[model samples]
Target: MIAAIALAFSFLTATAQAKVLELHRGVGVHEWLNWSPVNEDGTYIWPPYRAEQEWLDSFRKGTVSKGENEFQRIRSMGFDFVRLSVDPGPLVSSEGTKRKEALAILSKAVKRITASGLRVVFDLHGVNQVPATSMKLIYDGADSEGVARYRAMVKEVAGMLVKVGTDKVAIEPYNEPAYYPCDASGTDDWQRIMEATVADIRSVSGDLTIIATGACGGGVKGLLNLKPGFDDPNIYYSFHMYEPHDFTHQRSETKGGFASGMPWPASTSTPEAVRKALEARIDAAGLSRAEKRANLAEADPLIAKYFAENWGEKQLDARFEQALGWAKTNAIPSERLFMGEFGAILMTADGRMGADDADRIRYLTAVRRSAEKAGIPWSIWEYANTYGMSVIVPKENAVPDMNMLGALGLMRQ
Candidate 1:
């Protein structure tokens, strides 16, 4: 009798543990992830390439590894998710041989990631024969025909994922929608595109999560104003947060030209500065007095739109709150809101090569903490080179400040 009781207890304990593990194993309904490319040489190549012949040849020849090693390093750094870029053209080929090859590569990657206990987000980074500028389907006079072509391509990709039973894989319709231009009229057209794309994906697999990029890549205001389609729980909103691009793309030695030694946009540090800058620009443009006054009033509310009074040491906390409020107002649950891209570029006061590691840590730490507080998921801008957080081919061998990671409560040690 005693032996039997002990055996029963052990079996129940094991079953309970298994259930707990299973709950955590699948792609999370709400969680954070990091984005990066898987280069052939296992190192993430910085500054993602457009579909140029020279770039393609170099990438294929292993001259540019999209940082596979860096991805592993990111995993080691404690990230449980990854967003991989798939050039839609290559993945969806008219030639059966090319399509098979692409599928094989993707399948291998999915298996590898699953084995490593990570979830995957497949981003249709670029479409074939289409330049990056015109890749998105949302812009005015956008190749409507091209948009249809890419929609078909996405359906094909979604079909493959469904067939493979890879539930962890989600699809991002396009990488960055606002890299081109989309006015109010274009925005309406893009909504139709989004509705169509979502329907196509659902036709293949209703379970797949469809990530839609917002205007200006889902800016907070745009997201709040959006009225998503009817009863699509599988859809989510994504927005890139590389605000004040002038700071993020400061001059570098290798990529010469443009302004050299320009400082990070001062406006980002405070809302008042941002408002003042906007006012000055409107005034300088020589708008009619009435127009200028209207513009100023219109912009005034935006200054305090997403801020908190007691933001404290966490400045990003206010920003996150503002963004979350926008999402909530739009009927988007916290789970559906994500910080799709955000990272600080390292730049010296004199505009030199090495970045300010301390500042980078502070910025990232604030953002991470804010996301946790807001109950919103987030992904770092990148896992490697371009933004200076290259884990595999770091710009310098300097040891990471473990304390900084700890400050963000990311590193246990």
Candidate 2:
């Protein structure tokens, strides 16, 4: 009887000690299973143009005999985990055999990451490939049917991943939900959708961790808007960090224009100097005279606002307080909150629009350390792709920017 009692106690103790997921520093793995272009009918372009199989094969077959695969390289770079983003549109668009095959590919992909010795936060990142089955359907007040279909998809995927092992993967149902104005004035539809997302995954496995997010593009304000009344014990709240979006995303296809050479903390340089440099670049863009004038007109105010904000470590700390404060308010521990994604673009050596490498390092270090100081775990924006913010100098190569590594404290300065 004593031996049996001791065995039971051992089981209980191990159960109590086991974490749903243990993460310190992580990085996003994108453009592999995610962001694939879809057909007109919302179906995933078969044999995705992004080369999913070839990418996986690259990880399986190392450059050298008994060489390190990409995932192994990620582990060597000091990342404890990877938030593997997946474009779920294919599952939504396909049926029967096709759906099962798509899911199999995803499961194999997860196994590939673990084989290389990295944990995963399986992220369901949405894209605007098609309104019917895209990121927009769930958040923009779609019909109940659309919402139900999305919930079902999450449940199916979550169930499949947990079978691979609860310890290896967590389900993040959505990314950067765009239910704007995150306040009383905003739509509460996201509230219901977010709840259903958790409920769907919860229905799959009680032990599988769920990554919950707020509405407005997963920022701190968005997290503050959520009211998590969950009965489950395993969950991590997530929010993306790019507070001064204009600065971090500057010169990307989105918000910011072609404003390069800007510094972090804004106070590093005067607005006058920044404006002069920006105007010259705008002129050198070789647009028509009228276009140059228009570009300058568009660039001036954003520059003034960026300088006026004077973003630095202190301001970033204050911004982070909002999330930590929210956690405290909800009686949630700081350790349970996650900086799901944060990164600044790296300007290309060829002068394509991006932030300077030095500036990027400073911003990355400041944000990364601030999150650490707050006792929060963070994952940088991505592992690859020439999307401006990758740690790899060239998207195609396995080279790590030693400076970026130092900035993240992953390598010795």
Predictions in order: lDDT: 0.51, 0.78
Candidate 1: which pairs clash? 39-65, 39-66, 42-68, 42-69, 43-67, 44-66, 44-67, 214-218, 306-322
Tens-digit lDDT track of model 2 for 1-413? 99999976775454445455878899998878876766685566775435545554443333333454677878998998999989878877766787777788788889989888899999988877665678766754734777777888888898789888888888888889888989999977888888877766755566788889998889999999999876244788998899788778777343334556678878888888877776676666566777656666776777778888888878888889989999888888888899999998787544436677778889999999988987888999887666667766554445677888889999654
All predictions: root-mean-square deviation over Cα?
12.2, 4.8
* lDDT winner: 2
Cα lDDT over the full model 2:
0.78
How well does each candidate superpose onto the true structure, as a TM-score?
0.63, 0.88
Q: In model 1, how many backbone clashes occur?
A: 9
Model 1 error, position 340 (Å): 1.5
Q: Residue 71 error for model 1, in Å?
A: 5.6
